[model samples]
Target: MTMRSTMLLLAPAVLGVAAPALAQTAPTILPDATVLEVSAEGRTTRVPDVATIRAGVVTQGQTAAAALSENATRMTRVLAALKQAGVAQRDIRTASVALSPQYRYAENQPPAVTGYQASNSVSIRFRDVAKSGAILDALVAQGANQIDGPSLSLDQPDAALDEARANAVKIARARAELYAKAAGLSVARIVTISENGANDGSNPQPPIYAMARAMKASESTPIAAGETQVSVSVSVRFLLK
Candidate 1:
């Protein structure tokens, strides 16, 4: 074909491709709309039914083997005491074990290894919160040197969380209704629902200084457990009519 006729045939095909490209590159214009965001919080309180304590043995010796041996012996006694106190074997678990060199630092000098320290920790779950204090004291007498936490919790946290969730939904609906009335709009339907988080508000009780205190040869340690709280938060979007 002649060059002029070939060029004429190609022009329409090129224009067809360019038209779609231009349409795709075009910016879209959106209509004006208002967005409303709201947050709701809810809380539920319950007397804690269970308690967890973290206790351990720490031993230091001139050699790693000696330190570890001493720690193991003490931990054995602690475990035995826990079992005797009615703590189930399944509820008691070894959380951590470590043997590390202890260093003694001197002014303007490289530190020297002074001794070896061995630590073994066990986490104990007490189903009966009332007996938590006594359990702690018993463990201390049995040779637990390091006591970290008694983080109070619930055995069945799901129930409490559900109650809190229901309360949260109620709170959100109330707030949304109030806002809708103020804006002269009616509730249409729920657009979205989301959970921010849920938690058992069991604060870690202060570490008991039971290990440091000198106990009478025959005295039993006294312990106390306070109440625990559970909380939940949710975000819901309701379409306005």
Candidate 2:
């Protein structure tokens, strides 16, 4: 074949390959689109089913050994009373124990050691709410010098969580519908859904001093556990039809 004829044939093939490369180099812009982000919260309230109390003995003596011995004697009586009151062995546990030196500080001199202090604390779980007051009174009479806590809680939280989750979904759907209607668009299917699990508020706090005094003086502590609320939140994205 002649050189001019061969050059012509090669030129067409090169141009064919370059055409696609040119198209790839060109920038393409996407059409405008709208996305709606909505957040919904749900809450469920329920009465607590269980209670926990921390009670113990604190003793002070000239030496650590003597202080610990005195604390042990009182703690033993307290534990025995708890067991007699129908508290299971597994439900009772030593939460803390410590021995520290008591300090006596003079106006300008270095602090001096006055005595040794020993403290032993036990945590008791009460499944029966009706008997919680009686149990506390028994511990006090048996020698529990330092008593704190009866943090109430729910034994089984699964049901409450389920209710919260369902409510969250309902709230999200309603919000999406509201936005869609306001913008003059028909309600469409959910494009995406994300959930944040239940956030039950802060840990239970012990009763206030006034309530505690009333409880202490009454024949039986007027035990009342108000409802606790569990809440859940969710974020949802919906596609416009």
Candidate 3:
């Protein structure tokens, strides 16, 4: 080959070998980040703005039709009483209706049906907690034979939950920073946040609530709507510097 041809071939090979090194410059590497994990719980206490109750009637008669008719009549009166007590129609709901045969037992013999029984129930929501007692009193006076829970709750829970969530986040961050500082490190930034659970407390029917069962026509049923607690829990991880 001529010298120029040889030079051209050699130059191409030299440049090809140097291209990889030129592209492979040292890159800046970041140090491993340290993290702190923390968990926190937050709670807020607020009075329930709404209450729910279940009331019903049970009747029996010799015939199925008679028992059902009596139950229907009683249930109609009970519903009217609820409406008069300021319970909106939308808030009153028919929970259940059932008719069953009543049986009598004899020694060493198969039981025989003695009569027919009918039952009807309603679930009511009392928007005004203060008036729930009076409403319950009216229900009893209207001949409600079966009564159940007055479960309490907030009408709208978003605001309460938001407050609780904010508190949880603030506490979680604070604790994470405290732990990081104790370990001779500074908080760099929040790495991740996760919610563990949230709960709005229950309105358990206390023994005192049973007093409504015996309320007289002249007496107002007394009910104590205790405070309800909203709770939130969170887990957080923060970067430590």
The model with the greater TM-score, 1 or 2, is: 2
**Local accuracy of candidate 2 as per-residue lDDT tens digits, 1-241:** 0000000000111111111221133122123434455667777777877777788888899999999999999889999999999999989989999999999999989999999999898888888877887888777778887776667778887777668767876776777677667777755565455664455532477543221232346585545666777777765555544
TM agreement with the true structure for every prediction: 0.78, 0.79, 0.80
Of the two candidates 1 and 2, the one with more favorable lDDT, higher being better, is 1
Judged by TM-score, which candidate is best?
3
Clashing pairs in 3: none
Model 3, residue 189: distance off in Å is 1.3
Evaluation by TM-score, superior candidate among 1 and 3? 3
What TM-score number comes out for model 2?
0.79
- Candidate ranking under TM-score, highest first, comes to 3, 2, 1
- After the best TM-score superposition of candidate 1, give how far the Cα of residue 180 lies from its true spot, in angstroms: 1.1
Candidate 2 segments whose C-alpha is farther than 4 A from its true place: 1-33, 200-203, 206-218
Q: Which ten residues in a row have the lowest lDDT in candidate 3?
A: 1-10
Q: After superposition, how far is residue 213 of candidate 3 from its true place, in Å?
A: 6.1
Q: Please, what are the lDDT tens digits per residue for candidate 1 over residues 128-187?
A: 877777777788788987776667777778887878877776777777776777777765
Looking at model 2, the pairs that clash are: none
lDDT of model 1 at position 163 = 82
